[model samples]
Target: MTDSMSDTLNNEIIVPTMAQMAAEGKQPDILFWVGCAGSFDERAQKITRDICKILQHVGISFAVLGTEESCTGDPAKRAGNEFLFQMQAMANIQVLDGYNIKKIVTGCPHCFNTIANEYPGLGGNYEVVHHSQLIQQLINEGNLKAEGGESFKGRRITFHDPCYLGRGNNVYEAPRAALEVLDADLVEMKRCKSNGLCCGAGGAQMFKEPEPGKKDINMERMNDVLEANAQVVASGCPFCMTMLSDGVKHTEKEQEIQVLDIAEITVRANGL
Candidate 1:
């Protein structure tokens, strides 16, 4: 969108708490699940804030888990530790069940995949959606309007699909719908959709060194972005954001291209 999609929120943000809603004997329309990255990673935190800004702008009743939230164990499970994954999932399930949460939305695809697919068998079952999907729904229902050409009017942007959200879950349209509202020239990589390339950050590879390949997965993936001649790289997952940002830097194209989350782009387009 703009030169700085990660611009700080100048407006006072009002994010409700599940506990506070509970005290009032009420429930939120959706639970904003700030996954581990959204809660702790500096860059990912901005996506979290932007998603909140959009939710607030659209007047949606959403609340965060706050202190009651824990890791979804996506990383742990992907690292091949089923026992640890189960333990972490069970702990989060307990907290979610305690709150009686019904619907969930998160900025991380890792958490989205884990909660929506993996958590069900462990006694955690809730309607979970990625922030991009939620934003698309909002836009479709006329809850979010970004029709005015704010920024990213005709910029060449390419979407980098995360494995968890795409191949793992088969969610390919929601993120694109959110981008369509920006009026940007959405380009496609040679390897996209079902054939999309991984950003090299999935399956907990982000927490460990690579396996001595000729080139890092992210670098290879970045090549596709470069080939598309995109001005901005749109990503829907926080993990993809980190890896793609690194790839842009590694290619020394940080000034020429930008890596932004879908929520960040949506907020910037809507002037949130």
Candidate 2:
């Protein structure tokens, strides 16, 4: 059967999610999949590249399939455009099948959740992990080390948990773990984890303009960070990074505060 036809057929079959698929078998080795959010943002792309570099230094053999990358259809799916999401999902599955991708690592939380949790329904399944988790593993194995620099000692930082990564996928620890690895003094926001506020950029809000609300989602998150007197705000998802960065800028707090991805901070901690 033609590849497209095969994908269409696969989509019709219900399959276990990627996490379930991972649990069902020995892990596969070879591919690192970057979803649209990571691929589209310069900083996020850098983080993914840096992660691969770190893994390469530790003798992990893998390849990045950026050109083969596509949106996880998360936005469409979350926005209630199931048909478009399915089409996108099928297309991505076709690419993965072509590469025979057995394992995937992603930086974006939304992409991670969608590819790991939702793709099974469309018959695409693979072992997927957030970059933070992988980095933590590397650190534990003595494969990755942080060459401490001027400590962020006095600079208080707060973490804004991305909805998809934290609540949607229950990946609250990895990012926090990564920050802790940096020896960062982290102050938790009153609203964190499942109760964390949205950055207003999820569910494809990044692609479309945000609707009017009592306050901008990003602004709400920024206020929480500012209230903590944090000099830096760290997040796992690129959309969150971008939105929160914009939030700081919009609030005229750019000079007083900064937004960074966990990976970026990790690289810095290691004096990369």
Best by lDDT: 1
- CA lDDT of 77 in candidate 2? 93
132-206: candidate 1 lDDT, tens digit per residue: 899989989988878542588889998888898999999999999989878789999999988999998888898
The 10-residue segment of model 2 with minimum total lDDT is 8-17
Q: Candidate 1, 75: how far from true, in Å? A: 1.0
Error of 2 at 174 (Å): 1.0
Clashing pairs in 2: none
List ranges where model 2 is wrong by over 4 Å: 1-28, 148-150
Decoy 1 TM-score against native: 0.94
Please report, as a residue range, the 10-residue window in candidate 1 with the lowest summed lDDT.
Answer: 1-10
Instruction: Give the number of colliding residue pairs in candidate 1.
Output: 0
Task: Give the residue spans of candidate 1 off by over 4 A.
Answer: 1-10, 147-149
